[model samples]
Target: MTEEEIIRPENLVYKKPTLLNDTPMHYCPGCSHGVVHKLVAEVIEEMGMENKTVAISPVGCAVFAYNYIDVDWVEAAHGRAPAVASAIKRLWPDRLVFTYQGDGDLACIGTAESIHALNRGEHIAIIFINNAIYGMTGGQMAPTTLMGMKTATCPYGREADLHGYPLKFTEIAASLEGTCYVTRQSVHTVASIRKTKKAIRKAFENSMNGKGASLVEVVSTCNAGWKLSPEKANQWMEDNMFKFYPLGDLKDTATANDSH
Candidate 1:
């Protein structure tokens, strides 16, 4: 009838996933990378892929993801995770290969590689974290940064003439002929977390089944980079980020009537 009693296995409603290491996460207080990482770890454990999965992580805020997850990881050059994953998946067709990358790494510097990998239909999963600002690099502007959003590189706010436009990379991935599934999700609330977890699981499943490429794009919050409190960041994300990058399945070739 106390704290220990409530934490007892018989009364416990939730517990940390075993695949997640005991080490403390380095993500910022309100950042969503930790949540997404936990979900990925849970899915891997639930799927019994701890021994057959490989994660390729690139530079960005979530770059240290391998330190937290108990799995095989290959640290890739900046913006080269997808290409690295392609080679790994080719050599080990039976293993589940995936890439964990951020917006700057995927939508900007690695745009060509990310697109070509998906278009080629490599049997791999891609977990993309889109937090408008570049969180790890002094809050600079990224390709996914919303119009008028201010960042270190855009002190006066992003302008169309100078910044072009926010890239819809998920939609672009969905348009590819090779991608088996592509979905965009967020993790600000319990319901959203559940949805994102499900999407991530689907991505892993698709890869394991040789169904071609699958991309799970997580629209995340970077409170520290945004110069806002955790709560305000979530509120701002819902108010601004969600508008341009709505949550939904961009593509689902597995469910389509036409054969892949």
Candidate 2:
């Protein structure tokens, strides 16, 4: 089928492309960040927050996310997206605010910012992209790098004595009293994409309802960094990454509030 036939106007009625820009993303083929971006944009469009949404992009491969998200975005300093997000949300309490950060940006350099933001009960959404390796800076050793995983800096494999352990960011963030909704999902396949979209929509909706900080960690793929074929990289994330970052809702107070 032709591209026009696939994204026909009728099909785009409710499922329109909320993401912006005509240029293709710089992500390697089969990268999951693109899917995650699409999911977030769709949720914003569905909720009619296109004009009210603001996003902070981290200093990673996703740094250029502003070009694609079509929302008013601020390019934050490395590891400072959370700080920027906090300020933006506070300055304009009526706007829906979020930050898109990678494992290195969020789990490593921005660790303190992330923890404090969640701890402060900031009503913002965090789209955490955990691919285990630092994708933008030549696949360096990231804080979330798995034990025994090899990287540019850790060619001998990640050693506990030197590199430390992989971070369970969602779990840690959820533990904070400020976070109201926390979940981890993946986008390796069509079915997984659907599930991720649901989780992302819920997170945004919860934040809009005055539900404090919400986090949605997306276990993503880095075919180039992992040195695997596109299909193989996805398979690897599904098998290994999912094992480390299990998929599910960590907290859902709104649904619980309604049900109770």
- Per-model C-alpha RMSD: 1.9, 2.6
Measured with C-alpha atoms, the lDDT of residue 103 in candidate 1 is: 96
* Residue 43 in candidate 2, Cα distance off native in Å: 0.9
Model 2: lDDT to the true structure: 0.86
Q: What digit string (tens of lDDT, one per residue) describes model 1 on residues 94-175?
A: 8989999999999999999999999999999999999988899899999999999999999999999998999999999999
Put down candidate 2 lDDT per residue, 216-237, tens digits, no spaces.
Answer: 9998888888888989988887
Q: TM-score of predicted model 2?
A: 0.93
Residue-pair clash count for candidate 2: 0
Tell me the RMSD of model 1 versus the true structure. 1.9
State the displacement of the C-alpha of residue 8, model 2, in Å, after optimal TM-score superposition.
5.1
Clashing pairs in 1: none
Clashing pairs counted in every model? 0, 0
